[model samples]
Target: GRPLTFPPGYNAAQAFIDRHLDEGRGDRAAILSRHGTVSYAELAARVSRCAHALTGRGVRPGDRLLMVVQDRPAFFYLFWGAIKAGIVPVPVNTMLRSRDYAVLIEDSGCGALAYSAEFAGEIEPALAERRPALVLRLDPAEEAALFEHGPDRFDPVPAGAERDCFWLYSSGSTGRPKGAVHLQRDMAVTSELYGVRTLGATAEDRFFSAARLFFAYGLGNAMTFPLWVGGTAVLLDERPTPASTFATIARFRPTLFFGVPTLYASQLEALDQDRPDLSSLRACVSAGEALPGDLLHRWRERTGLEILDGIGSTEALHIFISNRPGRTRGGSSGTLVPGYRARILDDTGAELPPGQPGRLWIQGESIASRYWRNPERTAAAMVGGWLDTGDTYLRDEDGHFYYCGRSDDMLKVGGIWCSPFEIESALIEHPAVREAAVIGRADGDGLIKPEAWLVLTESAVGDDALEQDLRLHCKARLAPYKFPRRFHFVADLPKTATGKIQRFRLRLGAEPAG
Candidate 1:
């Protein structure tokens, strides 16, 4: 595939708003909600009103607007409001606890915040603690009442394509989250490269994304792509558990679904008991972690649709490697998407041949320029315009990428480096183990030894024989050096809001006492 380019005047992305709402498919539903469906005209008008409201509250071009809301109509309004005023929209995860939210609020350095009233109390004290410039209460119900009189026509500010657009933070699974900054051009690049080329989305397609809008994956799939193609995007205002997710899919009958690996796995399990009418789901995408081959096979068997897996990060904005539908391999995170260049480089920065394990480096117009306000970390993370993904991967002979694990997550036992994924994947293969996390801890001899924390499939408590049997199973499949030295039965593993295993927490559990 050839490199892709964004359309001219992309920074003025909202400039096309009138065209979308007027000349284009105005009758189509732009957003579907349980309360009501919003047409293209309504969504555009609300966005314009929100922008007017922000301006009246002292926000201006080049300012930052922090949005912490669920997948409601107001979320899109606030997002476009920021764009309309030439301000950057920084979305904070609603699933974060109050303490985490406190840290995020401080880190974002946003002058103003426009958030749902539901979360106002949770963040109010935190806001008081930091005291941002302005706090605008965004009650959707209240706004709807006021929308009756608000101006119907407003103009968007002229912004250049290279202007700073928005900021997104990492999930901070390891520690404090890092805020990644992207240009306005990145949004158009994502739509052109992924939406137009990879997804083949059009105005008629309805998109349903399980990932939250606060997440990079969700932002790209749910908001940017649909808007770019003049398609409709279904926004679920609640947290997407398997049950609620399927119910929304059934009601909306979305043409495309985007989710994380864990979400897909849980959905597959739910289908086994009582299936939802998902026939309208033409394409599905997975990210946030490696899609297990077992889960992939089972999902296909159940849904009769292939789950296309991809690899992405907040720094890169969204997916870079994706198995585009028809040309997919069930296991591999397919070749690089258009408009991007990827290389597998060894420790010393030499390019590695195909099939060799190395750190994956990617360079593209879509890549975020730097982590917001953290020059030292940014310098360490990105080099020579390439974003160091920190993921160790190998490209097969066919140029498809396979995730090994994070570079820091690689365990060193004796002298050889081992990927925790190998052990975790093997552990999950056992019938009794439902989920597993593997980490290396210092043994009595000062050598690193692998330890496994497992969530059992059934009640196998007090079964010493079962533990020994699992150990033997690992011994048989893995080399002696690679097998876990100890196993601990756990009810569940610590996970972030995105359902990613908090591997750092697991490592902390294995630490020896002072």
Candidate 2:
């Protein structure tokens, strides 16, 4: 990876937002929502006003502000406003429960909390548990009235690139979410490497991401990447159902669409019933999970757009290995993006040969400094500034990386290591299986064996015949030991807020009823 360089007194908001205004792109559309379009100058003014409002309320530099807003223009204002004011903003997952919010509030030690009125039910309970000094509820009319009194020309605080600007809680599939502390330059590094170099985004592009604002994937897709290129970002406040997603595409007509594999599968099913106008999309990207080859082929066949699957995490900020526009492989996460270096190492930490599965370690400028207040975990994961991705993968002879599941998700069956991803991929290949997640379930003999939870397609039955067919399907396709010993029919696999399958929950025998 190339050395990252930034000038003195650099702030991400200044680079992504203020620079557009300074470069005479003030009139260009910065955000497009159902309400209306906001130009770069309009957004900057809103940010300035919001900053004034925050400072007037006693928010200062280095203060932490907890943001629980949905995907809307106000989210943009509050986020950049906090950054412009030199306050570290922690954008929490909007789908979290009250207890989850309480965890973040206590962990981040945020002095204030800003949330939309719709989330008052959850926020109030959390506040009751751990109240901050300031609580700002953003009711539309009241917030407008409050912002109107704010100064229009407030100077942004001079925070350098190295300053801690924000914290994103890790998606806690393994345990409670940990805050990943990110510097001001982290977003810029990812935007440059993945957004600019890989995706080839331009000012003419309009970006729409199904991932929400709180997650690292969403922050980059909908906000940072688009703003980095002076492009327009489409914001959606509602949950992204297949119907809603299709409608958003029809209405917004964004050029670059981002989503996870689960959403992609849903959209494909929706498209099968009614093909909508997706002509506006030039490219689409998938992350949060490995996209199966069968799903990719079906999507491309239906939509004429190949989904460029990638592997990314909260710790590394965004996608480090991704399939590019013209250089995409069906099932492989493409070569490492420019400005990032990746290595595959064995259990002993020695570099592994290509085509051998091992733990993945990535080094890049965008990697988080540490898991906030978690010195033990940070010391274990971050070795000499190289982030242990905690994922198992192999680099093919062609230099493309293939995801073999998470390190903890891999199972030892019959004295051989087997990746659950390989089995899940095979299971999804069956025509009846819409989605599949495999985990190592202990049998009566105290031996770990592969078990699968499957979500069948709409027309598929969940009777003995169907299960038998699926078993035979895997038996014919996978190794003998890789075949699932038992299959559980499920309506949906457990997933995180970011749409990642929660294998740990399944491993702990938490499978929902069929």
Candidate 3:
């Protein structure tokens, strides 16, 4: 791919919000939501007004504005609007405790806060704790009269390519989250590398990601990618369940769908009883976790569409290594995208040979320069301009990368390294199993062994007979020691907000969510 460039005075929002109008796509539908279809023209107008609203309230350039909003038209207006105004907007997960919101408020030291009324139970208490200088409740009047009444046009403040534009909190797949500060050029760089070159998105494409826009992967999938290509993006405010998602796809008729592995498994189970029209989709994408090979095969057998699964990080902004549109390999995070370089390295920092598992390191223009205010973590992760992904991977002879478990999540049994994903994927291959997670557990001898936790099918029973069957199932598919010594029938596996399995949570007395 050719190098991406911008004019002398470029704002990141120009590519996403303002570019469509410049390219003669103003009347095109930019957003499809439950509220209504929003054209690029209408979206741009709202964004400009939103920028004015912020400025009128004394929110200035370089000031952090904490956004605790949901997935809606308002999200687009405020997010891009703030960037256009030269204010850094920090959007966080809506489903969180009050303490979490409070932490983010204090962490960002934001001068302004915009929160949805729907989450007032959580947001209000957080505000009561540490209020910002400007607070806006996202009521009907707040959305329209406040932001909508302002001037419909504002000059986009020039944000050079090197200027910090936004901050995305890490998904906390391991434990603690870090704020990844992204520069202005990252938005366009990733949209070009992965969205256009890898997935082949264009104006004709309609995108619907089950993942919401607050997270890094979702930001690219639902917000930046579609906006960059001038494509129609479908937004859902409600949580992404099997029923809602299927119904949405049927009604909206999106050409490209994005989701995580767990949701795909659940949707496949629902397909066993309900057949919804998925003909509108040409390609489905999976991220946040490695989609099991067996699950990918099952979906292809049921629906003709293939899932282009890949790996990405909040630090990198979006997918740097991905399965190409027509060249997907189920278990592999396919070849690197055009602008990125990947390395599999040993514990000592030497590059590992092909087929050897090691920590993965990546280099790309979209990679975040550093974590906000944390010099220790910044130095550790951003080593010599390379981002240590903290994920263990092995590259096969075909230049395909296979995901092993996270570095700290790998288990050693009988002196041989075992990947939790390897056992989990094998367990998911069973007819009764819908999802599976494996973690190291200690026996009476104090030696670590594999323990399996499973979320079974609706009709399946988790009795002794089923346990014996699963034990035999694993014995036949995996190594003798690799088969789980103890099977724990669970309602669901604990997952992060983005749907990646929380193996660390499993190690802490595995309990299902209510």
Candidate 4:
């Protein structure tokens, strides 16, 4: 066994630019957006100027710098600038309401707030009352002027293994958001896992993912992974709708495409009518939810790319178990990446044998040190060196792991435990079903009964027989206790922006029992 370690006194991100900032790579595109392209030379200049501006405003090492910006060149510059100055950039979801913003701002204890002009209207009024001094705005003209007047380069700060690199806010479904803190050393672990083992990003590769930089998966895959391998990343400024995302792929011709299963479903829905040129896509990766086998098959058939399904959490920073490009198993999440280990264990901490579903526990160097300011919660989730992933999985005899529904999504039907994913995956196997979500509803007998919510494809519309046909499809594929007892047809399934089906919302909408 090999012990993972970071380079001695490493600030690799800044070191990368220190080695390349002067090199003439004007023709190499670092970032491409709908508005325009940003070459590596331009990006480095802006980052240096931004670093000087932040330093002038008293920003220093260990200070948390909060930023709210859409995916653009400015966002990238500010992020790298903060890292260069040894300040941690905490990027929040720009779509959050004022109250949500207030919670994150107060919780993170950010010293400065940075914003883009477009988001100023919504954020300015919210922060007007408690105005922080370092209110840096992302104006391209201002950045250009600053670069012209300021020195071309600044000495990059030296950061050791324990130095704080960045903070990622986890979506706290039950309570306030918790910041999953990461140290500088976590970079080496992440690069080895996602970069070398899973994605194998190289300087010649172009990586594109639907997740934004704020989200952990997106932040690592799009920003760190690409830069670690000296590759380019395509950032989508606007929301990644099915049509817009396809258009970007067609134009950019990204070598690697990353998204969730819901995004894949959307792409499949729109693919039949409008076939975008996805010929350049070399590999596809799906996360945030279980990638149903049927959806994987459909996407592969349409795009001619195999989707490598993965499972990860914010606590672990990113994916540890991901299907390798050439050795993808249609229904498995693949084997654990090097430098990480996963186990399926019961509540009592006993390991489960193959084919038995249990809570998945992951131990890795990339795991977050702890939840910020929440010692009790951190203690509850992290035991010894392993982090309880809260996800359920079953490993087959072949060592490939299959994702079951979340531990909370399990329901008891006639005293038999059932996973909603089993029902949903079976429903999706039907040709008429576009998407499906299965949740438990209390029935007349006072026992939880499984219900299916479905969005039908055009081929299945206006045919009353389609619903029964889908039911039969599930009946043939799954056990009787796991079949959906009720069906509700809808235009779309309720999902988070990251493409996770909101099972909690479904549980809220069920009819009250007598």
The lDDT for every candidate, in the order shown, is: 0.80, 0.89, 0.89, 0.80
lDDT of 2: 0.89
What TM-score, over all chains together, does every model reach? 0.93, 0.96, 0.97, 0.94
Higher-TM-score candidate of 1 and 2? 2
TM-score of 3: 0.97
Query: Which has the better TM-score: candidate 2, or candidate 3?
Result: 3
Cα error of candidate 1 at position 161, Å: 1.3
Tens-place lDDT per residue, model 2, 1-514, is 2245777988788887788878999999999989899999988888888888888889888889999998988889889988999989999998879998998899999988999899999999999888988899999775795455567666778888878989999886767678999999999899889988889888899999999989999999999998889999999989998888889999999999999999898888888788789999999999999999889999989999989999889999999999989778887988999888999999999999999999999999889999999999899999998999989999998899999999989998987889999999899888888899999877777777899899989998888888788889988998887888788888988898888898988877754322
lDDT (Cα, tens digit) per residue for candidate 3, span 1-514: 3358987778988878887888899999999988999999999999999999998889999999888888898999999889999999999988889998898999888999998899898888888888999998999988986567877888899979989999988876654668899999998999999999899998899999998898888889988888988899999988899999999999999999999998999899888889999999999999989999988889999998899998998999999878987788877888888889999999889999999999999999999988999899999999887999989999999889999999999999987999999999888899999889999888777778899989998889999998899889999998889988888998878887778788888899854321
Sum up the clashes in candidate 4: 0
lDDT of 1: 0.80
Clashing pairs in 3: none
| Candidate 2, position 184, lDDT | 93
Question: Which 10-residue window in model 2 sums to the lowest lDDT?
Answer: 505-514
- Tens-place lDDT per residue, model 4, 204-234, is 8888889888888887777777666567888
Please report the TM-score between candidate 1 and the true structure.
0.93
**Model 1 lDDT tens row, 159-231:** 6677788899887666678889888878778777888788788888898999989898899888888877788
Stronger candidate by TM-score (3 vs 4): 3
